[model samples]
Target: MTASVILAPLVPVVVLWVLAGLAVAFVALALWRGLAGWWLRGLTACALLAALANPSLQEEERAPLSDIVLLVVDESSSQRLGDRAAQTAEAVAAIEAKVAGMENTELRVVRFGDGPEDAGSLAMTALAEALSEEPRARVAGAILISDGQVHDMGLVPALPAPLHLLMTGREADWDRRLVVKNAPAFAILGEEVTLTLRIEDQGAAPGAEEADLTITVDGGAPQTYRVPVGQDLDLPVVLPHGGMNVLQFATPAVEGELTERNNAAVVQMNGVRDRLRVLLVSGEPHAGERVWRNLLKSDASVDLVHFTILRPPEKQDGIPVTELSLIAFPTRELFVEKIEEFDLIIFDRYRMRGILPMSYLENVANYVSNGGTVLVAAGPEFGAVDSLWRSPLAEVLPVEPTARVIERAFVPELTDLGRRHPVTEGLEALAPEGGWGRWFRQVEVSPRAGQVVMQGADGRPLLVLDRVGEGRVAVLASDHAWLWGRGFEGGGPQLELLRRLAHWMLKEPELEEEALTATARGQALTITRRTVAEGPPGDVTVTGPDGAEVVLPMPEAGPGKFETVWQAPVVGLYRLEQGDLVRVVAVGPSAPREFEATIATGEVMAEAVAATNGGVLRVEEGAPDIRLVREGRPAAGRGWIGITPRGAYVTEDVSVAPVLPAWAWLLLAAALAVAAWLLEGRRGGRRVSGTA
Candidate 1:
């Protein structure tokens, strides 16, 4: 119970002053007229003023609110490593018990897990939010239970009390992590890309022996190399083909210590072409020569070198020598010497014109067999007696000309297999009103053992793809494709179709017949397996960096395309496999922010807590018991902790009663004046008589 004096004005203070002025005037009049009452009038005015002030005693009942203690727990991925989980659980239980026994104190526990959007533990952010919801008067102190690895320190709120930390880790904790500091997202196929990498040792000696590193591409045989410790190294790697190249780099594990799951890193580089060098050889100068030149010249990446036999040896024109404007064609310089310099060779309506000898034709076949691409855009001459099939290059071509020309208006259609091929799939948008276009002419050709991708009029082979030794070959049996560009029967995707076909023949990885791909977006792994033949669903085994294996079942995403998604439990290199196919992808950082440096240091949280007059306490010795300490006194003792007690009070009612009535005050003033006048008059008479 509490008591205090409060004043409620019964009458306005100005009115009380007016009443006192009237009383003073009456006393002065009585004294001047030989009536004595000055002292009595002053006494009456004092009593009247006191009564109008309306003084009353106020009482209140209040109980002090308990001091609040905030407990912040770190539940990030790093806390789950090794014995740290058990240690955190035990510490949390002990903290709850200690907080329960304290008098005039309450505990508020806030648990923080891995942050959304890949931010690490948001302990400081959580603490700041909790502080904003509660009153500062009731909060006495704050305690944090973490591994001392906080990501959002700038979010620390303004605290009115002391804060402390109970770190969770051993003094001898050490870790080593593989770091790929800089890596390119895309690299040209067959070209070396320099990758900057570093191997860092945390809480370990720098002079330790260098570690052995192994690098593997697409899960092939790993190439072992030795890398020195605590230094950045530039590694030159050549991309195999166009598409996603999964490269895994790992360091040898150590003995009798922390886990080695984070000792490796995986990088994915999308392969591209630095330049497309094409050699277009034409037998004679015709209208199709400009078409081939325009198509190849449209792409900025394509380096086109076109040659045409403007004058055949048999064409005898009776004219002076060197009189014609045409220059001599250099067949030997192109096909015999610098043939390897070009990535692809295109025969556009070329025949046995005798300009390229039989030896030069054999050299072109050898070029295709030695990892070079070739495309034969056949014309009516393909069925002539001098067809290319009669030359040494016939072995590399996928189809054989049947000496028959099919000239009819028919629409080009995708085969059942072509509907699933990346080159022809999803190409309906290229046609007008989403309908296939019609071709004016197509050669009659019989497909060999290779795959038939497109069928034309009368169900003849329109396009064929086959492998020749280590290279790829393709045949487009129509020279009227340019007619589509001229909007014949509603133009189609002439450029896109031609581009995809040319790129596929160059052995781009994304267009491979059999492929295994994995893409990571945040914590989800989207795995795609593409193949031509239908078989059992491939086994997708994702091996996390911690050596944990999770086998996923892949369902069909599309025709001949199988897909599955796995929510990754931790960040690291995830190995995917299906039969002989294998791929590696990085889910998150190989070393998580928490485990990046396992040593428990209070460096990050120290400044934040210090702003609130807090200190860091190592839990190795034991946590102190929390207690309420008075203000301006020591907050902690030898074995116990102290918290400041906060006293709070709220009003129940505010109504106040008047101390006196207005009529009573007026009557009392009159009575006191009359009595004082009579008494003073008698005293004056007695004094006069005594003096006489």
Candidate 2:
């Protein structure tokens, strides 16, 4: 309870003050002049003022509030490393008991874990929010139980009392991580590129001055190298093939290490070729000759070597052979020597004219068997006796002529296999609306051994493709395919069909008839299977980073592409296989942000503790005692921490009453005035018996 004096003036405060001053001056003047009636007049004025002034005494009742203490717990990814998780659980239970035993104190526990969107520990941000919800004056102290690897320090709240830390983890903890300082997204094939990499040791130092590093490309055997630790090294690499190249770098796990995940890294870089060479052979010039020439010449990456046989060996003119002849390029150099230098060879409207010996044709067949690609565009002469199929090349051709020709307008149809073959799939020639333009001429043929993807008039095999030895072969049954280029009956996808066909023969991975590919988009792995199988291509076998395998079925996506997306469960390299085709891909980063620094330390929260006159103690030394201390004093000691008493309270009830009554003041003033008047009259020797 407490007492206070308050005044309720009858008039305004300013007016009351002026009247009091005037009364004081009047009394002083009368005393100096020695006047008796003046004293009586002063008494009457005082009585009037006393009655106007209203004063009261107030009493209040208050209730005391307990002090609040915050206990922040760090449960983020970094805290789970090593023994920190166990350390945190033990410290949390001990602190809860210690805070509960304290007098006149309230304990608040806030647990924070891994942040959303890969943001690291946000200890300061959580502390600020808890502080805002509680009264500042009632907050006695703030204590944090963490590894001290906080990521948001800018949000640290101002302490009303003291702040302390109960740190987790031991002094002997350490970690090693692999870092790619710089790497290119693209590297040209057959050219060396430089990549900068570093190996670092954090927390406790390792005894070895050098570390063993291993690297692999495209899932091949790893190559080992000895490199000094804590230093950047430049690595020169030459891409082995033209496509996606996966470069994986790893360091062997050390004894007493925090985790091995950070010791490995994965990088993906695209490999591209510099140039491509092609060889084109024509038996004679015809209406469709320019179509093949125009297509090859338009591509800046291709170098075309065109050879046209204008005269047949059987042709015997009356003029001498020397008179009609000009410069000639020897066939021996092209067929027998440097034949592998060409990526693709196209024979258009060609036949056996006896211009070259039988040995040349046999060389061509051997070339096809030795990892070379050949395409044959046949004409009406393919069914004749002098056809190239009758030579040694017969063993390599996908089909044989039936000595018959069909010359009627017929629209080419896509076989079930063509709809699933990458080269012919999704071509305008397979559209639902009447398909492509009609061809007027096609030769009837019996398929020897290959995939017959297209049919001509009377359902005859129009296109056959096959693999002979290590090379590929494709035969088109009609010369009228070029009529589509001229928009003859409304043309077709002449350019698109031929381009994909050429690329397919060149062994483009995207156009392979039988292929398996896995693409990573965040946590989802999209697996696609391309095949010309009679029915469904079946399930795909997936191998994870830890060598675990799972068979997943594929759903049809388009004509030839079957796809399915699987949610990845972990971060590492994933290998996919469908039948004989295999592909390797990575789903997530080998080293995530959480594993970069796994060792526990209190340096991140040291500034906040010191600013609030607090101290940090290791939980390994046992739970600290809870103490009550004054603000601005040291709040921590060897094995104990302190909280300050806020002494906060709220008033419950109040009472106000006047000390003096109005009538008593009036009676006293009247008596004083009457006595002063009688004394003054007697002294002046005047009769005092009359009442006026």
Candidate 3:
């Protein structure tokens, strides 16, 4: 309990001062006039003033509160490198013990890891939140144990006490990282695209002047090149095919490097064709000839070359050849000279004609065998004596004509295999309830090789796709496809089906018959396996950046797609393999923010620490001793960090009592006035006796 004097004046403070001034004036006047009772008058004035001025004594019950010390521990990915994790653990324990021994102080610990969505270390954010939970008045100081690679510096709070840092990491630590300065999202296929890259050595990399750079595309074989470190490199690359291409660039990690996580980087660039060159050869005027022509003409990217054989060499009409108004077809130039330049070659109702020699036809077959594409749209001629099946091109054709044509109306339908094939996977869903439009005729054919994706007229092969040595071949055994385009009976997916078929032939990655793909959001990895093979495609084996492998079972999500979502343990590159297929995906980044700079320093937190009058010390040197200091004084020194003692307490009960009551004061003043009167009478009586 504590007691102190507090004023409880009967009148206002200003009124009490006025009354005291008047009493002093009256005493002075009586003394100056030579009054007999002057001394008594002075005593009476003092008593009256004291009675009017009231005072009280205040007492309180108090309880002292303990000072709070905040400890923020960094558990982010960067701290896990080398011996930093061990260092952080040791520092935390030492701090806890030191605070436990300090008098009237408590410790509050806050531990944090990698921030959400690869935001890196958020030590400042964690510190601010922990400070808000406790009383600012009770907080003595805050200490952070980290590598000091803070990513959220903007969140530093206005600390009420000093802030100290126990930095983790060695001075000799160094790292080699691959940096991609510029990479385009899309590049033209078969054209050289320039990519800017740099190889950097951070921290104490001694005598590192040169390094070997390894580059790989789509998980293929790697190529090595000797490049200068600390310099920008312009690499020229040509994509082998059209679609999404994954390019991986890496440099060898040195012996003393902090981590190999940033030694490699991955870039995904989409390959697109500048222009699609197509050669369309029509045997004669046919109903479906316009369908292929119109479709190819509508696309701005397609370069269409069309020719029609209106008159065969054997046609003996009685007219001069000059007046025939017919220009000789450049078969040699198109078939022999520039065949490879064309992306796709289409034959509309075409048959083996004497115009193109057997040698030229052989060249066409050779073209398909050597990385070229051929699409056959057959008519009744396919079943005739001059059918292409009877020529040199028959080797690449997916179907063999049976010399028969069915002239009955039937709707085209997807075969069991077609339902799983990427080209025709969802075509059936676009059809009406009554199915697709009817085709009046279809040539009878048997699948000699390759997949029978579509069928009609008693399950006869209608559409078949095959892959030659390094090329692709597709056969559509009818000339009535235009019927669907014309809305003959509610047009089917004429546009979508043909588009998918064309893109598939062009080697679009999304339309591959068998493929493995992955996409990442945050640390969750979505793996998708697309195939037409029977049964489950089996579980996928995932390999992380740390070379740790995990086998995850992929459940069937669709007709031919197997998928699963697995949470990645950390950020970095991940390789997925199921059978012979391989796919690589970066979970958060090829180089996570934490590993971007592994050699830790306290420079990032220096300004904030200085503002709070705190010290920054290295954990390798030894944990500093914790001490208590007065507020507003320096709280850190060479070998010790300090917290301020805030003399904080809570008042339980307050009591206020007047020193003297108002009525008692009034009675005492009246008594003093009567005594003064009696003294003055006695002195006057004595003076009267002397005068007598």
Candidate 3 C-alpha lDDT tens digits along 519-628: 88888899999999888999999999789999999999887888999999977778899999988787777888888778888899999999988999999999999988
List TM-scores for all candidates, in order: 0.82, 0.71, 0.79
Tell me the whole-model lDDT of each prediction, alpha carbons only. Answer: 0.79, 0.84, 0.89
For the record, the alpha-carbon RMSD of candidate 3 to the native fold, in angstroms, is 7.0
Q: Candidate 2 residues 1-692, lDDT tens each?
A: 77798878788888888998998898777666666667676887787676677777888888889889998998987787788889998988998888788777888999998776456788898899899999999999988998888888888888898989899988888888899989898887778999999999988866568999999887789899999999999999898766788899999999888888899888898887566688898988898788889889988988999988877777767767677764464688887786888889898988888776799889889989998899998898888998988999898998989989998899988788888888788775444355678899998889999898888898889989899998999999999878888887677888888898888788776888887888887778999888777667899988888889999999988877889999987878888887777788878677776776777777878888999889999988999998888888899999999888999988899998886788877787888778767766776623344577
Summing lDDT over every window of 10 consecutive residues in candidate 2, give the lowest-scoring window. Answer: 681-690
Cα-based lDDT at residue 461, candidate 1: 93
Best by lDDT: 3
**Predicted structure with the largest TM-score when compared to the true one:** 1
Off by over 4 Å in 1: 1-63, 204-207, 282-295, 308-330, 428-431, 534-554, 567-571, 627-642, 649-692
Candidate 2, TM-score vs. the true structure?
A: 0.71
lDDT of the structure predicted as candidate 2: 0.84
lDDT for predicted candidate 3 compared with the true structure = 0.89
Clashes of 3: 0
Please count the clashing residue pairs in each candidate, in the order shown.
4, 0, 0
Of the two candidates 1 and 2, the one with more favorable TM-score, higher being better, is: 1
